[model samples]
Target: MPNTGTPPLPDTPDNWPVPPPPRQEPDQPEPRPGPNPGPETPDDGVPDVDGPADLPPNPPRVA
Candidate 1:
């Protein structure tokens, strides 16, 4: 059998190309802190979040 040589490697620094410098984004006005809004409530002033009564238990997974 004839001898086969390995292919040449790409030109890279430590097998990785040099990354570009981080980009600079334009500055925007700083946000003014205030009272954070709470989650929405129903007209009856009660949260409509799900509870154990919301859904049936999941079926067992098949092997």
Candidate 2:
């Protein structure tokens, strides 16, 4: 029991390093287009966004 010989693999170049260039979805910061983007209408104009009686009757038991 003595012939240990099986360790040498680093030639990876067929399609290995090419798969890491497709993850470019991280440049997202261009979202500010509209008459209201978000949160801005509480002068009785009503935009509190709750409706359904404000939805808080009973939703706390998270044990």
Candidate 3:
């Protein structure tokens, strides 16, 4: 076959041109905390309930 003038394909992976590294995005600033944040505390104005303690105790089961 006659040569087409184009360079022959690389036989090994090492012969190929290395690709450019991926672009990196700029770092974002952390958010600032407001007056009140996170979970609510008992002293946050609303009264706290007794929860499970308010329920009646279970009776013992006989064999």
Instruction: Write candidate 3's Cα lDDT for 14-53 as tens digits.
Output: 8788999997765986677555434544444444343233
State how far residue 2 of model 3 sits from its true place (Å): 13
Badly placed stretches (over 4 Å) of model 1 are: 1-7, 10-15, 29-33, 37-63
TM-score of 3: 0.28
The residue-by-residue lDDT of candidate 1 on 1-63, one tens digit each, is 564686657876876867898977659866887655456544553434542233445899999
Score each candidate by Cα lDDT: 0.59, 0.53, 0.60
Clash number for each model:
0, 0, 0
Model 2, 1-63: lDDT tens digits are 565796656787863455555556657786875554365434464335443223335777899
Model 2: lDDT of residue 62: 92
Off by over 4 Å in 3: 1-10, 29-63
- Summing lDDT over every window of 10 consecutive residues in candidate 2, give the lowest-scoring window: 47-56
RMSD of each: 16.3, 12.6, 11.6
lDDT of candidate 2 at residue 43, scale 0 to 100 = 49
Candidate scoring better on TM-score of 1 and 3: 3
Listed in order, each prediction's TM-score against the native is 0.23, 0.18, 0.28
